[model samples]
Target: MALTSKDFKYVSYLWDDAKAASLQGDEVALLLYRSNLLGADLRLTNYGGGNTSCKTTEKDPLTGTDVRVMYIKGSGGDLGTLKRNGLAGLYLDRLHALKKIYRGLEHEDEMVALFNHCIYDLDSKAPSIDTPLHAFLPFNHVDHLHPDAAIAIAASKDGKQINEALFEGQIGWVDWQRPGFDLGLKLQACLEESPGIKGILLGGHGLFTWGDTAYESYVNTLEVIEKYSAYLHENFGKKKPVFGGVKMQSLAPEKRKEQAAALAPVLRGFCSSYTRMVGHFTDDERVLEFINSKEVARLAKMGTSCPDHFLRTKICPLVLDLSPDAALNDSQALKEKLQPAFDGYREYYRQYYEDHKHPNSPGMRDPNPVIILYPGVGMFAFAKNKQTARVAAEFYTNAINVMKGAEAVSEYVSLPLQEAFDIEYWLLEEAKLQRMPKPKPLSGKVALVTGSGGGIGKAVAEKLAGEGACVVVTDINDERLKETAEEFTKAFSRDGFITAHLDVTRGDTIESCLKEAILAFGGVDIIVNNAGLSISKTLENTTLKDWDLLQDVLVKGQFLVSRAAVTVIKKQGLDGDIVNIVSKNALVSGPNNVGYGAAKAAQLHMSRLMAAELGGDHIRVNVVNPDAVIQGSNIWAGGWAEGRAKAYGISVEELPAYYAKRTLLHETILPEDIANAVFVFTGGLLSKSTGNVLNVDGGVAAAFVR
Candidate 1:
């Protein structure tokens, strides 16, 4: 059967012949190209959910003779971004020879250790558990994917019968079994029994397809997915109401967003009880549709059917008891109910662990649900980082599609609890978990740095992001803000930080900035009040407008930003930091600096008051006083440098040396020096200290805290 772009109604046919021709005869490169194409679409497979392989003739280093090598995606590698080094290469003959020593299913884990011995390239990456699923097959190229459409049929009550009818026996069917040597042999046997089959549907799992060439295998995988998708879509259309029809209406788009923002921090706080977790929210239409359906709670509780889905999203989602209307109308009541809901989910998870533990099973992990479903709003997914959190939500969305398709055709079925537990607590999975890199001190924290368009704000944002914090880089200057955003985007990627035009003096802009922070990375955990301006003038020379401007931006700005951020921090119930960028003029009496000095003094005192008031909330407020940060300082850029030089009777270029010579340490203060002080206050090192002042002006004696 010839297939074209028109045949792929549910999936995309992205094969570009010109691009394929560029790879030409390099087998490994062609395999990567094919794998990338299939992995590109979420409808085909999920991130890190599938593996691809090809057997190619290679020159053996030792024997200097041609030998067959099986190259497969390595452990923990995403096919979409896979590189040559991400593939594990093994001698085909050696992999085959392992069958002679295989101790059967109970001892299947031991095969993983033996795989190292068969490495064709000594520097090849570690082989994944699915290596055998491709290695044991006779085809030159193979694809094992977890596409939602295929899994829908695989997870249906009568999957085997449906698969037989759909493919007319061309694609075989295999019952659910954990992936290992035993399953590999079963796959081999299935192909042997059906000598002319193009693929096999694994009951309650996914799909496996193979071909003589990489293009053939890629097309075969797509055909199987598209066919299942078309069949499911046809059936879904016949069924007027999906998921038992919508029992509740979704809130309006804006209302839904407002509700999600209000709920995210509280949910994140509950989920992070054991360890800090980052959150991702989705009011995506598909997500809202499922949560609005009558069978949503029931289906979510039944859990996801795919192993890949559950591994990321957990066994099931925690469904909130409140509807969208109630959540919007009575927020206080919703807040009161959240704790009990979270507690119940945690208890349920603990019980699930207790009921399914084997003698040698790994100890229990955090007993919190990764996915949380609200009846009217949408979904909230939490994990160690933003990307993982987003991916978990994506995986669950795929599971929802599978359930919708399965229920439309027959009945959706979840893997048995015991089977899911066995896979979840598998020793191999534990080992993989252990191999992950240790997290940075600020790994799951989010920071909002004001005036980050340049100067100390920019440095502070970069430093925090480097230490694994998601930063909200903000400023009143739109042009500089965009430039800073571009630089941060290049340095940390978009996920690491977001840019916002923040005028801290205005309540509305401050609210908008905080809302941006909440939507981008859950909530703000650290606040760097670095935004300010300086007017060098005597009391007689300074006008009322000058005094008001300095007070509004320097003193009131910090106050407004802190007050807004505290609301979010309190909702999260997480410890937070507020580091104010003050100046030495606050303490030291100086000529031509009355307005700026008064604002600085007020800012310093306000920080102390906030620290005293917020201590009970575990929010630390500190001060960093930096003197003469002339280089890269935006305040210095706007004629303040010339004014300061005039005050000191020195040329503008000579001011840096004079300021350095004046400091006790005789060191020039840079923006980075001020940034380091901010990090010290917020980076968990001084987790116990608060209301303290750190001088970063090369030991300014007058600014030193008594």
Candidate 2:
């Protein structure tokens, strides 16, 4: 009753390799097929999560002799959302040679500069952060992905049992390690040790199987996954593909786009999945089947892709069905379904590690699923890069195959709860986490900009709000704030914009503004304390009366507002960020405005202390100093600049230009310019870096730079 390779079913699709390239023997036709196939996988995952590589030893355009250029899935692509140009050409020689570097690169920073060398298409956001994996594979056709069916298996309690049952002696298992040439080296060793090993399984991850031909690799993948599905079905006593529920069909691309445009915002907040239209394929077949199928539909009632898919996909999919409106109910249901699966997965690792580990043994890896599926929606897999997606899918397929087979014979066993926790919190996955490419993790996050009506504060807010953040513009000047909000509205849309009249100098107003923000979206994730005012005068010219006004706005105002935010943030336990807009006068001495500089300086140091104190809450605090943010700022254009210019015996127009051009890095400072600096401070990666000062001047401060 043991399962064999013959148990799986598949068909191979092929194109003539000789006709793949151009008339120059480039094999364009075959390459096109690989790209098409790769796109197909993206519909299954996200094309950015999978990889397609074409190796040609033919003469390069420059060398005019035998050379291999490996095209990898570049960063910023979603496999199901990829375009033709998404394939990035990597210098095959450089990649192959890099495969030989043995100096223990256990760091992603070390390889960041190195990968920049072989990148293709100057416009290709960045090479697939996983080129090294594709470079080292020794096969003609290598398609790696995190398939939905497979990730569910990999993340399950039954993964090891399933993989072993399906591949038996034919697959190579590699514990979760950071993927790169090192992983490549491990694969090579495993291949050598097991001469007949057909593919490699990256445990707690996804899939990678290759063949001498594209058709062979594709067929093996198809067959292996089918085998995996069978394994899941048999073990769970799952019936045949449930088809009697709904018979939904594809909507026109236009309709899909319209629906996606309307729904993407709500969906991202709900499922945290990428539903963009970037890949070559869309989710017509899968979506229709998922919604209509009785078996898969039952899964919607059950909840999530679970332990298998989380590695490539996340825990759930955002459903667009207006009728269900079930996230409020289903979210709790998902946690319920996840509990048993999680409990079982943990015990499996505890048993294996306790029995097999030695003092020198590597630590247990994560047991959480990389991808999750929604029956009426689609499957999603989360990976560090495209290559990770590839191995993850393969691992997923192997897990599914064996889980199904074992269930055919008897009930499948799952890992224990405690053991699964140990793996989920393991150091091995932590190592891999360090090697992941830096992304704008704040991408598509909405940032509400306070005091965005003008000046450095407005600039800082706009910058953070510009980089994919749904900007909610606020200012004491309702007219100005509305104007700022309208500029963005004209460019993006109403969904991307919001406006509120705010006076950050008041705690009650700040609190009400934030409440309104949460009502509009879900919660405010970023805060740019860019709302402040400066009163100008010499030390001798200044009065205690004017100083109090400056302190109230610069020092007390920021404190009162951020304090209110901390209350909500601490309760939510979210990674909320707070960026204070300070000035270079805080860092260096400022002319004439003695009270202004002192207030700014006090706020700057206060930012540092807040960073240290609130770090436990995972809230980040950073400061930005725009040496000169132009004269048209509210402070200048509001007649404050004219009086100050007269006091200095300089033309009002000359003062701001002097400040702007005086910086060592002589570049004019714009509001959007200052906003860019604020973005880096509040966005991801700076998670560990808080309590910092960023000079937005064109090198005027000369502090951090040179």
Candidate 3:
């Protein structure tokens, strides 16, 4: 069956109910992981554009009371697939208290933060900015969305006119107001004014409808949007203008030439695919009727329904009248003509702010017109995204609809620029920016680690990631590096760990990998030069090839990556850090380890010089020398024990005791210990110290570094 207007209404309402359903079950989250309705609603609207909430009763552990509380969805969650914990449970009383702050204070931003604080640090997730709206509603579940049809109706001059046509006397109408407490307050008033009001339309805004069930709500939403959409289809689209068919009175040739120069540069960027488009505008029969009609044309109201619409549609359209054979003129002349219009827009903003925001606090973006609708120039809506332009398009369509309504005498007026400012700068709004979680201190910070697949590298990445740093994990093999990225995506954090194939010895690859890490994680904060190779050979017979192999990986790779990281660090004005994974070879002489010993020694010494030179920028440099470690391990594995046994002329089984017995203090060195050391040195604990080598060899190499 073809879906009717009623079906669409019910479906739209179902979205809100579905939002409630999502947070109630873990299964729902799995079902709609990325396409949550809550996300759709918010992203579709402007500024925390939507709201979400859920109902659950948890037993209070302290009082043993079955407190009826809600795990309301927080401000940042996408509703498409919310898990149970995505809902932050607010003590009904705490939310009620936060509500008082909104009523008593003049700031809406503050109120939002107060609501956020009540939610974020709680054992639950952060409460959404829409929490209060959900609280005021009379349902176990509630959600709000900006259905495109409804926004079109709400933002147009005929909002009240559209409301009259559809619901007539059945639903209530509200004047324009900023979202949040004011909306909630007016919504409450509408509920009282028309107890039977099934829904409401806020003039120059959108609609709100509720239902007892998801199906009921979804259906209502769809029906409402369809109803308005049909109204528009019938009223405004009867005869969209065709350039050649219309009288060419609006597109005088001279104005058409100016129009071409004004709009080409702006349209060029988004329309790379569109080879050409001619610009034309006339009073749609509706505009002409509007101009003649007392409601639209009276008082020389020759403008679009809303002054804000000018930002979307441009102040006016440039009528194109020139012949196809005409060549375009210089853009500079066009810019000069448009410059005054831009300044006029600035003055409007200045006046708007001056009138509305006393002791102004809210920062306004560029006030220049968002579009250039040159009559002969192609129509373009200025916006950062396709979505906003779509909004602009709807605004234009709505304007066409409302102009018909304006055939009657009275016209719609919105809150003045100053009242809008007071609303925009309201305490609750400003306060929302306050007490934001002390930025996790790791934002935009980056760290790179070698040999990060399974053990120490993994630990370090997770730890730093938990603190909010972006981590890049590298390994010689593609499989290992990608596996690390995948595992971290699941077990650690998504978008936290990146992988690269880096052998380290290849200078070109090292440089390229460093660039890749920056592009992935912003820039490097710490470099854990933890990859190395070791072999046991007597100095007398250690082949030049074997010697170079150890030196290449240990010294060359470690040095190159460290140097690359330092250059970026200095460029960023950061006090960078380098942690070299030196070994027990630097501390002690093991019998069959001539090649490994000489290589590690050079790497170790290079670290000391790095510390001395990089110290001026507060760049920390350190070495973690571990030996007698089991190599290829879950714990410091990878040729570690093999090297020790080969040096001592003993089997691997006996080397553990040999090292422990020789140490000043007998302590088993876990990889966690090395990871912790890396943490300690890179972060605050060791900030005052650098160029220090820490022996991580279970004290076996104490004599060497000491």
Candidate 4:
């Protein structure tokens, strides 16, 4: 059949007949294709929120005969990026046979372990908890999606009645039941009772649709969601004002962002009280509309209705009590109110865990809210990493859409507190958490590396990111910045780091770069002042311009960047590190290096001074001195190598060997070597030590710290 050739008001129709036809014979491939298409659209399903399955005939290794196999999305895998290996293939017969031994709802979790025996492929990924939901359904192809429009209908107070009326009984309605063996049975019973029903609306949950063919299943899922979206929009339009109308106007775009940036580090600090958390901020129109609305407090308290929504966002978001305008106008007052707000959220969350948690439940996870809503400013979502934080924000945004749609048509209804608690602390969910890999040492840290477009700065950024810190790679060279960003994207994925063009000598640029870092990953926790240029000349040859330029780039640049970042660091109230990349010349005092050496000496002393002053704030300031980081060094590229070679009476090629020979260890220092020294100072290895200098010059006695 021709794919739905029509315009969709909410979601895009991306089904291509040619693409579907290409995978016609491969049932699993078709399922993956369908899943990808659906998952690509946020309006259809959220990240890692839904699952799809297709039954295929595969040869059995034991019997050497054909057997029916169900391939479904694996646990914790996202459909949009699903690959062939990400699908778990289970023997359909074995899955069906396990039902005979199913004791009841109480023992449903046991069935999850038993699923291992049903694996069709030994190399298959772990099956999702929703496996039974797909296995028990009689259709050859099935799709279980958490589409916002469908979820809005399902989360409505009269969800069952609305489902019956909206689809004219074509789609059956099942009251709220946490997904597991029992819910699967309920789906089977619903279908058994009404074999003509096309889909099912799971109350306070999502929608389930199926078909005889993969394409048909894909189309059916879209059609159901589209109908609901159109219906909801029509009703939403009819209402004079949504979400009880806006309670207050949004701060202007710039002001809103400014407010968000100011609040992010403080909020992040609160969220990270127990364990460090990375934060993501959003000022999207939908978020602004919900938070600025009259019913925001009540609806936020009610929490999210969709299981997928709350799973990432927590039971509910903590709404900031302060007004946006007030937050923007008075920074000090905003900070005062924020502390109490966070304290209250923690107490409430602690009580929630105590009130509902079973003795066997995994000890309460972090008591901090994953999501925080600021009226007129925006929303902040915190998680252990940047991507997770960003995804959590996206999920909450989806929740907002779901709430809006539900409120427009019928009063929105969240899951009962008990039900919500059970799902949040589910043993199976706890097991999934246990399965996650241990976080890297620098996981929640954010670093801003100036001059990171190349050389020591790039190496330091890369090293920090490898250890799990989100990095902001800033440099004045636009071309190199782009290259570094692209390279980092390949190495660490897009979320690992952000690139900003920053001329460190310029105060405005320094402020802009710090603001970018704050907005990108909440705030900077580690500062690498590596941006610099060198001028090697005797006192006579070194003109006033030469002396001034060296000082501006080396000394003043570090001062501006550090001063700006300290403002953010103080707001976070977290221990911070500033690693200034000074040089051996600062201590050695060689000929023709007067201008460069003076600047390096100034930078070294400045770091010591900052360490003494900022010690009260727990912000450590240190220095990394490198003799000659010639390889991949932009400083060396700009005639410094030639000048140094001339001074040493050798060619530029001999500089590395000469420097290495001079060191007691006879080792040539690379940019990565400098990067490692910086990490040692900032990576909690020397947490108690501050105002110290680490020389990465392979043991230059003259450069050794006294």
Residues 1-706 of candidate 1 have per-residue lDDT tens digits of 3445445777777888899899978889999998888889989999998999999999999899999999999999998888899999999999889999999888999999999988997779999888888888899999999999999999999999999999999999999999887788899999999999999989889999988888888888888888998899889847657998989888898887787787888888888998898888898888988999989978999988889999999999999887586543343565678778888988998999999999999999999989999888889899988888889999999999999999999999999999999889999999999999999889999999999999888999999999999888899899998888888878886578889999989999998888878877777899999999899886798999999999999988988999989989988888999999998888898888989999999999999999999999999999999898877887877878888888899999899999999989999999988888888888888999999988888977877778
Could you say which candidate leads in TM-score? Answer: 4
lDDT of 4 by residue, 1-706 (tens): 3456457777878888898889878998898899899889988899998999999899999999999999999998898888898999999999999889999988989999988999988888999999998999989999999998998988998788888998899999888999888899899999898889989989988889999998788888888888999899889847757999879999899988888787788888888888888888899999999999999999999998888888899989998887676634344666677778778888888898999999898898898999988888899899999999999999999899989998998899998888999999999999898989999889999999989999888999999999999999999999999898789988996789999989988998887787788888988899999989988887899999999999899998999989989888888878999999998988987888999999999999999999999999999999998888888887777878889999999999888899899889999888888888888987777989999988888898877778
Task: Write down the TM-score of every candidate.
Answer: 0.97, 0.44, 0.61, 0.98
Model 3, residue 339: C-alpha shift (Å): 25
Clashing pairs in 4: none
| 3 or 4, greater by TM-score | 4
Candidate 3, 10-84: lDDT as tens digits: 123224445545554542232233225434443133323444554445667678887656556565554554666
Worst 10 residues of 4 by lDDT: 325-334
Instruction: Tell how far residue 288 is off in model 3, in angstroms.
Output: 36
After superposition, the stretches of candidate 4 with alpha carbons farther than 4 Å from their true spots are 1-6, 327-333
Q: What is the lDDT of residue 437 in candidate 4?
A: 98
lDDT, each prediction: 0.89, 0.57, 0.56, 0.89
User: lDDT at 677 for candidate 1?
Assistant: 87
Error of 2 at 411 (Å): 10
Alpha carbon deviation, residue 237, candidate 4 (Å): 3.9
